[model samples]
Structure formats: structure tokens, C-alpha cells
Target: MPATFIRRIASPKKAVTGLAVAAATAGMALTAAPAHAATTSSAADAKAIAKQMIPDSAQYNAFSKIVQHESGWDVDATNPSSGAYGLVQALPGSKMASAGSDWKTNAKTQIEWGLNYMNDRYGSPAGAWDFWQANGWY
Candidate 1:
């Protein structure tokens, strides 16, 4: 007699079950469900959304300039030092909640809040941009 070997293959369901058992034995919980793909917006998308929201060319350009400097049009942009967040870099981020609860992820919400802030504080986006240009913030 020389030697003999046999191999067995488990089905997908059994293999998954075995993996779950092994993970549980290692003190890990397999409570997470299968992940689904989520849609994400890009900086360009944010700009487009802003264009649609702000129809005035000068106002839109001014708003765009501020956002470009503040967040580079990133919806989830954050200032690590100031803790400012979102497209407009709302300090504390929670300030944008008055615009909408989805302020963190929705470009429209951030833009709406930013626009309102500019209108209320500086009279217009162009005015805000002027102030920002001189003071480096608005």
C-alpha cells in the first residue's frame, strides 16, 4: 500500500454556513446583511445642481467661486481644524440642519442653506464673494 487521498467540496450554502460558524466561534458577530450599492454624487454633480438652483449668472458665478475655494464643490468636504463640513463648509455642520436633515449628503440642501446665508448676511452672493475676497472668509 502506498497512499490514498480523497477530497470533498461543500456547496455554496454549506460553505457560507461553515464560515458563519467559524466566525461565531472566534467571538465575531455576523449580524450584517448583504450590502447593496449606493448612489454617490460628484463635485461636478454638485456644481450642476447649483447652476439649476441659482439662475442669475453673476450670483451663480459668485456662489461657485466661494464654494470652489471653500470645498472644491465636494458635498462631504470637511475642514479638519474648524470642524466645518459640507459644500458650504458650515461650521459645526449642524447649522445646515435648518435647511434639511439630509444636509450631510444632499447638495441641494447645502446649496440652499448657503444661498440663504449669503442673501441674509451679505445681501447677495456677489456681496459675500467680495467680503470673502477681502477677508478670506464669509
Candidate 2:
């Protein structure tokens, strides 16, 4: 396998200095709510978006762990060296374009794309989790 693939398998959660940040500008539109409430971070938003997709607690837990390790729940988390992007660290990130056009801004898009990848590549989230545990990545 190529070194980038090996590195992804060995350290899939690699972090970079220039992570894209979700703008909180939308919160500015909330006239009644506190600015802080409107300022929900992408990490929290990603977790909420993920739970909506997984729904089941057991599956969500496993998925959550993998995503946490891979991204610290940051939808914008990226691997500078490998160029993997988003919550589950999809390499090239553009591959997620299959899931939706909003892949860059919407955590739901990334989550759905990631779930599809785990399903297609490893049979299921549990299977991906197992592979990640054994190999240090998924």
C-alpha cells in the first residue's frame, strides 16, 4: 500500500494547523436567543447531526468514538499531510460529494457520507470500529 494509506491506517486522526471553522454568522440572525446559544460550535453540531443519523445508542456510541478519535467531533478537522477531511476523515473529502452538495458546511452530509463509506468498505460501523481498533484507524 502507499505511504499515505499506511499513514491513514496508522494515524488517521492526524490534525493540521489550518482547520476550516464554521462561521457563527447564522447565529446573528437569531433575534431572541442569547448570542452564546446561537454560537454553538461545529463540534457540538456535528455530534447532534451524527446522532440524528445513527439514532441507536450502541451504534451511535461506536460511531461517536471513531469520529471523536478521528476528528474530536470537529466537522472541519483535516489531515494536512494526507488531505483527509471531515468527521470520519474521508480522504480527499470530495468523495463525500456523492452524499450531498453541502458536504463542506453540513455535518449531516459528512456523517451520511461517512456512514455510507463504513457500510460499503467494512460492512458496518461495528466492522469499521473493529478494524480501527486493530489497525489504529478505519
Index of the highest-TM-score prediction: 1
TM-score of each: 0.73, 0.68
TM-score of structure candidate 1: 0.73
lDDT of each: 0.87, 0.76
Residue pairs clashing in model 1 are none
Give candidate 2's whole-model lDDT.
0.76
Of candidate 2, the 10-residue stretch with the lowest lDDT total is: 15-24
> Residue 26 lDDT in model 2?
25
- Candidate 2 lDDT tens digits, 30-132: 2244332122257887788788888888778888889989988887789988999988899898999899876766688888999998888888788888899
Model 1 alpha-carbon drift over 4 Å, by segment: 1-40
In model 2, the runs with Cα more than 4 Å from the true position are: 1-40
What's every prediction's RMSD, in angstroms? 6.4, 19.0
